[model samples]
Target: MRLSPGARERLTIFWMLFPTFLVIVGFYIYPTLYNLELSFTDITLLKLRKGGDWVGLANYWEFLRSSSFFDIALNTVFWLTAVSVTCRMILGLLFALLLNASFLKRMKLSTLARLILLVPWATPPVVAVIAWRWMFDPTHGAINSWLLSTGLISDPIAFVSNLSTVWPAINTIIVWNTTPLVAISLLAALQTVPQELNEAASIDGATKFQEFRFITLPYLIPTLSVLTLMSVIWTFNNFVYVWLATGAGPGTFTNVLATEVYLKAFVDLRIGYSAAIGVTMAVVMALFGALYFRLFGVGDMQEKVG
Candidate 1:
């Protein structure tokens, strides 16, 4: 049978997308499904030889019944992810604005500031954590040393170990390491803002904030929204900063869901429980993605200027 032109085009498109769909299924879907399976089983370090028996949500119940779950979940959702993401967004936008300012470009300070921003992001995460960890050490950290010199702090604070300072210390590390990327992303978005709009706003007696609010911000909202969603997902799933910085130290003082998952699997040797936690994180993220798309369409409509 002979095919029509439209049918041929559709077939070609499907052929083009076939490999990508296969890759997505292989890497993402397969592992997710396997993890879902693992979550239901009584899998463990020794059970590698023999497949573990299915327990049908017993692992999930165990986590729920545990007293530490509530605190760890709260720490994960609120302080580690939400607060850190919020700070990154605010600080990123601030830095992007500073870097993108017209006057700052003339002064050449933007170049130096941008270089400084890139340094942290370009550094390896492990190295960055190590540096930050040393800085936060109570006995011999630059932070405490400076505090002592300035008479700002009577006693040196154990930032990574102490309960009161741990979360903030983690937040500082996260924001410091992550915010540069956000700022740089926003800076790129800022570059797309039309100069004519800003000029017109200024010509109309609009203030700087007004220029940003009306002219620049509208241009950036699409990028900002996508970046915000990405930041949340990345921060939510992040394992490195927490693990290396404090090892969930000072007796689970800075424990988040990610660390809990790791501790349950590697340290405590409970693979099934770890899979349950990971599955939970995936579910929460899936819900967030759906809500995000509902509030702001999957992608913004691009307006073409005549």
Candidate 2:
């Protein structure tokens, strides 16, 4: 039998996408499925050669019953992810706006300014964390040295060792390392906005704030939406800043889910239980992405991008 034109087109598209589909399945879907399977078993490092016993939902139940589960979850969702994402979004937009302004172009300083802005991001995350650790050290750190000099405090304060200041310190490191990407992306988006719109708005006697609110902001909506999703997902899943900076503690006070997963699997040697936490975090992010796209309207975003 001969295929119809529409069927032929559909077949062609499917064949074109087949390689990409295989990659996604191989790298993402398969690993996620394997992790899910591992979550249900009583697997440990000792059971490497032999398959672990199937204990349906036991790991999940154990996670729910864990004493530190809520505290770690709260730290992951709010302190680590929320705080970093919020700060990144705000600072990224500000930097992008400043870089996008005509004053820099007129001053011939755009390239210089961008390169300087990239210094933090271009540095390795581990290096940035270590530098921050030194700065937060109690006795001889830069921050304490400055504060003492300014008479802000009579004594050097231990920023990292103190529970009250640890979260903020970690968040500062994350924001510094990540905000450059956000700013550059937003700057690219800002560049795509037609200058005609701004000029027209100005001719209408609109204030700078009104021009941005009316013309520029609509163009940025799609970019902002994507940045928001990326920020949440990346920050939530990130293990480096939290793990390297604090090692998940001054006695687990600043522990987040990613480090918890590592500590369980590697340190505590509870592979199955750690897989359960990984699976849970994955599910939560999936739901959040779905709800966010639903409320934000993926259709509208595509329309704007197009």
Candidate 3:
């Protein structure tokens, strides 16, 4: 049958998008639904071949009642807040500003600075973590040796093996690995700020701090908001640094939600419980994203992308 122009256009559009739609449904929607279903079951390694019976909210209840749950939650919060997101923002902005300086641009040092800054991010994560692990070793590590030689410490400090230092040690590694990407992103955003605005502010008797606070910072808010949200999500979900560096620590002192999920699934073989933990993480992130959008108004960050 012959179709009208609008009908033909609609059909063409649907056909164009059909493949992507199928891929999303198969890869994303199906797996999420299957995971939700598994979270309600008593699935384990032994029952891998044979399906387990549904246990309703038993898995969730078990996780909530688990002794380590509170500690894991607190560790996760600390990792996301103190270690990753906040540190990345503070350092990223500082480096971006320094790199964006007129003197750096005039001297052609900005390019070199950017390249050096990106080294940590460009290196493989596992390799970087391993190197950091060695550096944090109490004996024969450069850090400890340097501290001893400089009279900064009486003896070597066992960074990874001690509960008090383990989280900070691994977090330092995470910050080093992730901060470059944040700085590069912010640098691009900084470039978008009009020079005229800053000059105008300067001519109006504004101090450097006041000029940045009023002119530059206001322009960067949209970009910063989006980057902050993305950083939070990525940092919270990051399992590699924590898992590779200390394997969740000398004890459970540095164990966060991601590592706990990995341990529950692979090591303990509690598939259903792991699924519950994963679901909980997803729910928490979703709520955080919603609240972030409410506070930040979901500005047009796409335009700021370099």
TM-scores, one per candidate: 0.92, 0.93, 0.95
Q: Could you give me the TM-score of model 1 versus the true structure?
A: 0.92
Model 1, residue 283: C-alpha shift (Å)? 0.6
What RMSD does model 2 have? Answer: 2.1
Which run of 10 residues does model 2 get worst, by summed lDDT? Answer: 297-306
Model 1 spans with C-alpha error above 4 angstroms? 1-15, 299-306
Q: Which stretches of candidate 2 lie over 4 Å from their true place?
A: 1-18, 304-306
| Distance from true location, Cα of 245 in model 2, Å | 0.5
Candidate 3 lDDT trough over 10 residues, lowest sum: 297-306
Error of 1 at 168 (Å): 0.8
For this target, which candidate reaches the highest TM-score against the unseen true structure? 3
Model 2 compared with the native: what TM-score? 0.93
Compared with the true structure, all predictions reach lDDT values of 0.89, 0.92, 0.87
lDDT of 3 by residue, 76-160 (tens): 9876455678888999999999989889889989889999999999989999999988888889899999999999999899998
